[model samples]
Target: MLAPVTDHPDTAPLVDAVRQLRGAVAASSLPLPVEQVSAERTNRVELLNQLDDYVLPRLTSIDAPLLCVVGGSTGAGKSTLVNSLVGDVVSRSGVLRPTTRASVLIHNPDDTRWFADQRVLPGLARLTGAPTQQDDPGQLRLVASRNIPPGLALLDAPDIDSVVEANRDLARQLLAAADLWLFVTTATRYADAVPWGLLQQATERGTSVAVVLNRVPVDAMEEVRADLAGMLMQQGLGQSPVFAVLESRLSEQGLLPAAEVERMRSWLSSLAADSRARSIVIRRTLDGALDSLTGRASALAGAVTAQEMAAQALAQAAHEPYVRARGEIEEGISDGSLLRGEVLARWQEFVGTGEWFRQLDEGVSRVRDKIASVLRGRGRAAPVEDLGEALHTGVAALIASHGESAAMGAARNWRSLPGGSELLADDRSLAQVSPQFDERVQRLVREWQGDVLEMVRSEAGGRRTTARLLAFGINGIGVMLMLVVFSATGGMLAGAEIGVAGGSAIVAQRVLEAVFGDQAVRSLAAKARELLLRRVDEVLADERARYDQALGRVELDPGAAEQLDRAISQLKAVR
Candidate 1:
């Protein structure tokens, strides 16, 4: 958006990114893991959209300062400390996991430029105060305080990792919006994994940071401070200063050390929230945001790779049953039998001249001629016992030719497709499995036919094919003559003659092709694709359900991991 409109692609979506963060903050809706992933995708997409619409067009105008957002885990005194520093409860603070869902920005009136919410009217308490389509009176409470300064805004973030979950994310967005961090953690909270994780994030991107160790016990202050500071150094925040808010000092002043007490006020007042410092914070914060986005992009790349792998695994599993079924069907098609003794019975009828005994002399003569040709040539049309035997030969040949390697290769390939781990059917499914007929499914069908045709290459084999043709002629007459003689009108030619007519031999071939050719193949492919689709849906749903159960973690910012250095830096700068 910024690229085309302003002849610069870089600045286009900056405002949109801000708005997305702002919306995510306002919505306070948390998602399960899958939903979290979805939300992340949504957030990134929205940010890109914003850069085009709001940021790029205003590229010539967006000169705002950094907002140093102080966020933390729930019960980590995020709000209490904010109030203590600002000398008032600008944000509601409590012991609940989520004391604040909405983010509070504290700064002097000079710092007002950074507060861009359309809700802020002159002397307004909050955005909720602004009359608009979506308004809630109760939501408008945190007064827009003016004590911070130009180019600098102190953000009271919800929590880096809050069980309320939404607050955790509120903390994340606020972090992204900050130029620097006044990261706070008490002696007890300092050791937490969540905050450390966030601190590490700040260090990685070189965000100018300061840490405050609030409510430190008097007895263990030195030890805790040293250990915490050491950990921060290890996290590469060695230059960061740490400030200790002594618990005993708060008690002597008649206030809970963790509360908005006087000393905390004094320490916050000592920091220069003036124009120069504010400018530095603004640049640093924007750079930090860019770094964080880059990090997020890396995480998404990993997710896409995993998704692709899973999809491939599923495809292989679906193909297995399809391949096997086609192979079996081809064997059946070749022999012209489906669990029947018809093939052998028909062949015997033709070979033995079973029905020819009733034929006229001329018909019998034709039969004899054909048979003599076969016997003398040792024709390839040797009589078979049954359809079962013919089918067995082709099937055996196919399996033997492919061997175990082919079977294993198919199974291996299936592992790359989804449900690969579970494609092996149980006894019940195996029993119900049936081979489907199709001309294209398996090349074996052609092989089966070709093998049968092989014998017809020689004169002897051709003689056999001819013998079957002639024998059926004689029997066909015998049966028709009998039917005619039995007819009431003396019309022997009127009734059906033989069960297996000679002329009908060619017609049966046509019927087989119609059943097993393109029509059957198409039908089978559609069914297979449908079955696989159903299975894919089931697997994806299960994965998403598990992610839903884990939605609680979605709000954790990848940053809270560098508290010691931030604290050390703040302590050094203390008055």
Candidate 2:
């Protein structure tokens, strides 16, 4: 065990920084680039577990004894090598398919306190009695031995390529928690894919590694050692020292001869006896782990930003269609499209087209006589109810068509994104027309017609309004306002093909202009048009809000990237 690290002013903040980064990464959610995000999240979680089980605890208690993990593939003689190094059978060694199921950590009795608590490899439950293959495989069996030096502990980990996948994963976790890896392999299996793959990872992490090439025939020792040395150098691990233990017959006690592992034993003894050497090894591995975490944390932060951007894109996709729909509705109101077809026919029927022109030619006073006579029933006109119903149907149909179109457009946009594709694949109803759409349209049209009546009644200003207003009740004036809303022109004859009934619409426009003036007529149209457009926008907004609610379900912290960046900066500064 290493001596506990002396307290420094920067230590507390550095620990907090690491903890904060771990929490941020744990809380991050990604809905896009589904496969890639899943891989990233898994890797980050593994790194975080490594920090908690090894790096942070070790860094805080730097004076604790060093832990050297004995790790290798199946049948690599790892258990035998560990037992030989300690000169006792502390770890199980056999020809079984997987000799070690649970890990065995051997420490000097004097250094028991270091491994006694839930500080190192805290995820693993501590075990005291000898572990059987049937015992829960998740525990770590601690064995105290005076033969092991005071400043070091040797952990015999499971085979990296055990037939059981859980053993392989546990082996990796144990290696990640080690201060150094004492990797053992037979001369015959040194070039096997599994152990070398692990060696490559150790190199990338800058973790200190020492290789022991065991069970080598004496004649082939020099050649195999040189070739293994070359492979290690090519893999960027030339500095990792390799020791050879020649193939030999086991003694009656089932242990290698003392001479066979003498060099490896002496090296570990020197490392443990010399505190400075132990400290150097710990510092090298610790620094490497911290540096690796800094880079990984920043990458995780970038992933968070990507998630945020994708969510925003989905929201914009649902919002943009409504914006276009609102513009179209406003354009239709201003450009006289609403006055086409049925509206024009209804207005023409409301007054006799030929009689209006004849009365107009007789002059303004005769026109007033014509209007009063028509109002008093000299002319048979369309009922106000018919015009009002037609206006309501036209406006409601416009809203319904545009509302359905917006829903489809938003669904198409969502399908174009990876995250959205998954969400919509199972629930396509989100893209369909809303079930309550017709009812909403009915309600909105009723509200708009009511608004138009209120506008006419208010614009009358209660002056000289009793007679003409009584001649045509509130519904009559409200229907007239709806017609004027459909056309910006005062019903003037711009062209024959133009939708409005130029003759009769102008007569209605003239009557209103006379009673309410040209400005008041314009104001009524403007107010009614504004109210209709406002209602349409509200309907669109409600539809768009469904997508917004989906985005809200994903938890993405806006400040996660900056928090990671700041933590990395502070970590580097302290180091």
The top-ranked prediction according to lDDT is 2
The number of clashing residue pairs in model 2 is 8
**Which regions of candidate 2 fall more than 4 Å away from where they truly are?**
1-31, 34-39, 74-104, 132-147, 158-170, 186-189, 192-198, 214-220, 245-262, 345-382, 425-428, 488-508
Q: For candidate 1, report its TM-score.
A: 0.52
- Which regions of candidate 1 deviate over 4 angstroms? 1-62, 107-113, 116-142, 248-273, 291-299, 320-324, 335-340, 346-365, 368-575
Q: Which residue window of length 10 is worst by lDDT in model 2? A: 1-10
What tens-digit string does per-residue lDDT give for candidate 1 at 190-299? 88999887788667655667788877777998999899889988998888767777764433322344543455444444444354554444444444444344344444
List, residue by residue over 196-242, the lDDT tens digit for candidate 2.
Answer: 88888787776899999999999999999999999999999899889
lDDT of each: 0.44, 0.78
How many steric overlaps are in each model, in order?
55, 8
TM-score of each: 0.52, 0.83
Residue 568 in model 1: shift from native, Å? Answer: 36
| Model 2: per-residue Cα lDDT at residue 515 | 67
